[model samples]
Target chain A: IEYVEEAVEAVDKDKWKGIAVYVDHIDGVIHPVTYELIGKARELAKKINHPVYAIMMGHHIGSQCEELLHYEVDKVFVYDKEELDRFKMEPYTKAFEDFVENIKPTAILMGATPVGRQLAPRLAARLKTGLTADCTILDINENTDLVQIRPAFGGNIMAQILTPNHRPQMATVRYKVMDAPERKDAAQGEIIRCNIDSKELASKVSVLDIIAKEKEQFIEASEVLVVAGRGIKKEEDLAMLKELAELLGGQIACTRPVMEAGWLEAKRQVGLSGRTVRPKLIITCGVSGSVQFTAGMNNSEQIIAINKDENAPIFKAAHYCLVGDLYDIIPNLISQIKAGKTVSA
Target chain B: MNILVCIKQVPDSNKVEVDPVTGVLKRNGVESKMNPYDLYAIETALRIKEKLGGSITALTMGPNQAAGVIREAFAMGVDHGVLISDRKFGGADVLATSYTISQGIKKSGTYDLILCGKQTTDGDTAQVGPEVAEWLGIPSLSNVSKVTELKAGSMVVEMDMTHEIEIAEIEYPCLLAVDKDIFIPRLPSFVKKQETKDREIRVITLADLEDREEKHYGLNGSPTQVQRIFPPEVNNHREVWNGEGSELTGRLLSKLKELKFA
Candidate 1:
């Protein structure tokens, strides 16, 4: 919620004659959210006879500016600085805080991913403005001038949050929620470079080091993830699952029930209370598809679920499924995957 | 340490349905409740209050009806409550909502820790808490699963995401968005429910806060706007199995094999 409000705070003042979208950050390359916010921003911008201007922030971020023009913006602000080459809080916030004070755009929007969440709030604070996060929708009301509509409460209530007293309405949108606008390869836009003093960087937290790892680090780090949950009907089921997990690769995992059952170590479990797993592929033969389990593995890219109920939510999110008894499914599935090669010969 | 918990009254997400033809929210009879995640946030604050010996104030903005959530907060043991409600505040978006709530916080004068839910389920927009920090000029942590460490002046927190955990410190006046695992909200008691309802529910408005009347809040200040609201599309890519017996199993197995699980 703080990040969402920060996105709005970044751009709450100024009667934008045209829609000007602030670029949250580009890895020097445009993030997917740039176009999505633009597509939505343009529609609202058009209603008020205003074109959209997209802003970009990064070190040497200017080199990456021209590509943004094609994203359908009237202008683009590229705030360049060495400190931003890697995302450090102090430098990145300085670059954004400077650009926002100058340009005074209509509504700043960025994806509500991890980076945006952290960056948006800090910038909003520096700018001293209002921000709305994770908005499902964005639009303009000519009479009220309110960029309107969003959900609140646990996705149950739809509230219209506004910053009537503030300017440069800022908001950070969740990715994949909004549609990307139509891309015109030939479309053009203006670009400018932004700078902030290095002395400004001297204060604030310093990043001694950054550890960026690929996705597979989770499963590889665990020696034995004793995953147990509702499916571990008996203490012996833990042995069966451990055996299957050992035969293939990786550790044992379970639903919350298994931990409650005292059948496995709390640290080894893989549900909500336990650790979230990103194994190369999780093969759960007995577990049901509860939202708790889904939240842990929805990002795994690949999942193999074995359950008696075909209608389980897990099956929809899984890459593979086996509809059979777990007692029967576990042993068979393990043997097949561990074979290394099929019985083609 | 004084903890300020930002809470919003939300309808139950699972029960929300769309008007089949009009593509609008069916708010006709939907009931609103404390956002499930915010419940944890309040509890975390109360727990912090219990451990650190401090005050936990509950703050929110909504219609007069939003007092129900406040009653629940009092039941759970928040030190005080403030509701930013007014006629000019209807149709406020998250941006406006934040300004109103942040004003409420500022009006109260002081706070140490700020607690909030990761995101509201309905809008699924998690912007208010961080935005409040921005407006308040404070440090923040989003989706915090635990308070790993705390001190007299600064503190460290553990942020939980899909597969990663971030440990960071938040100085006083910092914002933190907590997930359900932060701490389950105390179950409301039928006894306290009646008791707190009788307790004063502090209500403030634009007038009381001495807030700007240019309407910096309530829908007018929002920029990115929603053009429409309807049921989210159900993207189902199901392959129906019409064949029976061996044929069905054969097709299913082959499909699994094709998916690289053979």
Candidate 2:
């Protein structure tokens, strides 16, 4: 049919080759999300019969390029320079844009981290291509189009999107949403060293300093999490929730509203705009369960949502749901844990 | 210095009723409000204007009713308002939306700074602000949690980069997509709303833009297409229990033990 003819002519499948994943590195340490992207890229590459390439950029990142070869990437492109020591929007975008313009990869994937979020849009604009943000699922269609699936409308709906006409279709995938590929001791790949022009490093914005967040409670590292939401009413009520989390031997986290209320640190907020956590167990207290907040913790192994409203959407995602006043339930649970009176199953 | 803040009109998340039969979003009666995050952007602009002494303009793109958000911005003390709306601009994605706004901004008067929300409740792409900045050829900073120093030519701000907070300085004529809680947003004033009721909102269509190519205005210019949209699959298997505090706690603990969590 004419539709088939148009589809065939629309994409020159032979022109687009290789799936490139950007390895986000900082302070000589590679983020785990890079490995996850590598694993995902390898899988997608297998489907479309394309090579997987990992692109890295940083000062003194030559030694790091070899480490990327241990993953499933067929080739690694490293852009090393002194001016690239700090993370600037201009230089980073320039490096990637220049590389894409030359190599013309089929697709580019990045972590939905802070740097990725800022860099992806600008680079996509410069390339005149499409970029999907915070994608939870990615796939390749028959036409070799990158199927980017993401939650939209405050997480009320899932929208499947495709960039049919653009080259090097780009997307930023959320961390911990995909499995990190295991490292091989004797893996093999090609490492290409790219030269960067100093002029390209010039940036309108300059980083003054990177202040490390104080490591008080690392929720991402915790096995169990106790999260509070805006429904908790007052900041003082956080004491009870904290005590319950303590009794449960878990760290205390919160939704964006709780942190906005100054009840918790920004580090403790978990959502699309906050941190993505995959704890073994997460108990949400008084959370109305907006999609933004739930998207961050939906991957937890076990979920227990406690809210007074039974119809609250949080229940839809919970393995165990308790519809009751958190004030009435948390205190009792705390005392029971303290007394250790419950018989073990 | 003049400041322009970009706001968006989105369906109220709480009231987005879905058609049960078709599973399509029922947009007819759903109440529309200014994007929640844009309130933070407006607050940031207001604070900067208060300290630096500048005029503030609020801009948006949508149907004529989207002028409602501009009016709301006026209620919050914006000096002026502009709405870019046209039938040709319908079904625009983030790329086309940002491009259209950038064109509208170019047609409008000049400003030293542009502000936008981190993301919209509907599109939630968080890309339009930076893309608009790219079109304007201005430096942009995203996830800006704190505005530290505002100078005559340059500004220093702290951006939440997830694991670390990086303080960065960008010269004037830059854009910032401020994160939430930059400042507690002030409530819209009824007095200002009454005074600004008759104020004219500048409306620009595709014809008004410098680039009048119809192909670059709406779905024709959009790079991505929505193949499908549906309500997320919900897990309806849930057990509800009503009991005294201690009894409910025991039941929950026992269930946790059964699930091997204990």
Candidate 3:
């Protein structure tokens, strides 16, 4: 094994540094979480009188850098290279490691997507720093420490973590937990293309083939969701829920049990372990809300729950709770919508 | 091929309570069980061992009571158990925890492969497996959904990268964080449990590590500090409607219209 010296010693301990938001993108299209973190970094940076930097790395991603310039970031660091076209762990870690050694940012924020979760920890370990993962909230203290808050212990508790003694305090914030800033028409930030060392781009792991899974709508981006719970009897019953979902121009989501039952794909599971969604409207059927399940969708604009048990925990998180069998309530509701009976506004 | 499977013990229930005043988890009476995800890792290791004719060792880092999980692994057919428990190793975040585990792995005998669950139920970071691999300077893969082939010197597996599944060949002396449902974990055999009940669980402490630096073992080694922990704020103000199905459906339509959801 080739022993690479730790990069922590290379950090300039006393240098004043800004907040860096890792700009995550695929095929040159930026992830919305990047903008959300930019908004958050801007908020935390202002208190400490520091600038916000967006770090973008990909193949032929200059246009995305141009797009990032309108979001009030002070500077954009671009690492455009063929080695970065795919999200290989080693090259991405090396590029970011070089960036951290050079800039010595006080803190780094990344989306808790698969790529970000993988990369953030590797960088943190290489730099001998700390990272809090899947953070739902971010704030700054008087000592310039970044406060990272996220659900812990199966969403029953919230932990407030701080990397007080580390440079570039790192965290992977969950997507859709924060609001993305509105993009301004006028571009303002400077873009600087960074160079990566050739040796740093070498990796031992190689991808043999890429198989795209069957296309399914991502529940995170859906505006409306019809969620099924354990109360749904069997696999065939999911079709009824799907009909209701389609009639309402929405998609279907479910709890862990429903997903585990193979009635729906794993992507449709909404909970601490699954996708965190903030849809405009969410109607849950026969779902007893656990903290794990509610933690993911409590931020929806409108929550209406239908369950037979009056004391089901889902009521606490719902704005409107209906106590009735979903088997009875759903078919009637579907028929009402099918009959074109519009309630007067 | 020798395999090392990393497992953890977590609260049996997700409803573990927190002390409002102390901001600490009230784990006094709550039962602990093997983390649900770790079963998949153990099962994967057992499957690989069964095919390749080798031994499997289960390792965990926690209090003395955590050795229970190690014993549970034995019932599932693990050959050996190692527990890294020390008061100094308390209150570790991911970096320190991974570092400590890496050191423990070094102290234990070398293995051709290491397996870990995608994440633990209590922490749910999914970061430790890769971080430990980074500390060991070995190639690591996470979200492994299927193990296609196990060779003498290497293994081929498919990784679920969310957008796409990529098949990759990783050499031995590497680590893999297997996702759930890669294989259904078998039930603990009562026969195996009675046979291995007295198997010794090797314990490693800070004194046993090659790196004797006290500053790198526990809370002192951890860079992240918990400012506070509190119960999640739950919104309890809700309009409860109970009525006949026909009337409730009509009322729900009106409510949806009021909210402009229809």
Candidate 4:
């Protein structure tokens, strides 16, 4: 099991040219985070005068290249092959290695999804580069260095990182953190179909089968979220919260404690450890706001929190705060909504 | 079967503060504990060892005090423990940290499987496990939700790929970073804790690693550098309401209506 280290060599910074976005997709449909990264890349590219490129790897994905061009990408590299259909770590990393060898991107952005998190590290290690994960902010400096800002130590402190010497400064950002660029009516990018050798796409792990889980509404994409916190006394109390969530045409979410209690699924948890959600309206009930909990949903458009503790830290992040018991407030609010007393604007 | 579980000691609370002037973590008296996620990794290793009859060795990289986590692992039924510590390894980023750990793993001995928590509570990068696998040039899997089967030379696992769950089989000498709730981690036994209190925890330093290049060990080896550190900005302009439940509910409904959320 012994491993040998390779000698380090200096690389010319000018050899890397463009800012590339990893276009993540399943089947043929594109992930929304792809456009968001493209949007961010377009901004970074303008400052450095570098081209914005999108590298997509999947089978039967040639048609999606034109759609990517609408997002102001200068070029789209497609590695469409049968072996590349499903995301096996080895094949995906190999294809991306080939793309990097040819394109020499100055910076690479990827969605902080399961696939991206797994792929980014392996690729960065293989290429001997640096990668900051789940970055909240990305900016390019005068020297074309990517400034990666991310929350560290459970969202208490924000750290700004730099890959000054790496050829392609890489970063993985979570979904909904950045805005997806507006789509144009006409496509304005060149599609370069890359032909990767079949041998290069070989993988060590074999897929036995893929079982598609039932499609449930993801809390990350929800426009409105009714969040339950540690103040929730009992597991059965979630039913009342569910009623309010459905009445508001949103979904029910919970804090880490509630999720760990087995009252809600892991995907429904909102916090640093869970999903980062930016809903149009987020209501927190009985949640004493720890930085870990508020960091995920503070970006929400309108936030309302009801907690018994007047000095709950969540109040600092909320637009409207109510100092009261959730047991009394939630029931009253449910009744008020049922009576149709509130008028929609 | 031989198993090596990677673990770390992190501050007990996430409320750890950073010094405003020095940009250094103010960790004078902050009690540290084994990262909560690593408990899952330990539990997974314990279960596999329980069923297959193997020795479980817990490994961690930190100061000498980090051996406390290894002792905790021993109380949870780990057979051996090792700590890789050196002042030269300080300030290492994920790249250098993983490389250092990989070197320590090679020195410790070979294992059929290497297990790790999904990520550390402090770094929260979820990158070290796979990067260590890469440095070792072995196949790795993340977000492994379930272990379908374990064979003599291979194991089957179901990975949560966000959209779909894919079951894949990987051969021995690979790494799998297990997610939380893989199993309800059992608490350390008081008896075992008392028995293993004086157990030896072998410590390895930078000089012990074969790659003794100073530039390849710590901050010098890391490509990424932390430029600045600051407290997160907070928005404190909020309207606080205190009243009867009925009155507050009515006001909340009106506010929701004004915002078109009703």
Which structure among the candidates has the greatest TM-score? 4
- The C-alpha RMSD of each candidate to the native structure, in angstroms, is 9.5, 8.6, 8.1, 7.8
- List, residue by residue over A223-268, the lDDT tens digit for candidate 1: 3232455755678767767775564445676677776778765666
Predicted candidate 3 versus true structure: per-residue lDDT over A136-175, tens digit per residue: 8889887678889988776778889988778889999977
- Clashes (backbone N, CA, C under 3 Å), per candidate, total 71, 0, 0, 0
Tell me the tens digit of each residue's lDDT in model 3 across B1-262.
Answer: 8899999999898787888787777888889999999999999999998898889999999999999999999999999999999888887888889999999999998988999999988888899998998999888888899999887778899988776888988887999999998999999999999999999999999899999887786777787778788888875557899999888989998776555445
RMSD of 2: 8.6
lDDT of 1 by residue, B119-141 (tens): 76565667677677766766666
Model 4 ranges off by over 4 Å? A1-11, A214-224, A227-281, A284-302, A305-345, B239-262
Which stretches of candidate 2 lie above 4 Å from their native place?
Answer: A1-11, A215-301, A304-345, B14-23, B236-262
Give the whole-model CA lDDT for all candidates, comma-separated: 0.66, 0.86, 0.88, 0.90
How accurately is candidate 4 docked according to DockQ?
0.43
Order the candidates by TM-score, highest first.
4, 3, 2, 1
The Cα error of candidate 2 at residue A223, in Å, is: 10
For candidate 1, what is the DockQ?
Answer: 0.14
- Residue lDDT tens for model 4, B1-262: 8999999999998887889898977888999999999999999998898889989999999888999999999999999999999887877889999999999999999999999999988888999999999999889999998888999889999988866898999988899999997889999999999999999999999889989887887777888888888888864567999998887888999988666566
Residue A67 alpha-carbon offset, candidate 4, angstroms: 1.5
The interface root-mean-square deviations, each candidate in sequence, come to 8.1, 6.0, 6.7, 6.4
- Candidate 1 lDDT at A146 equals 46
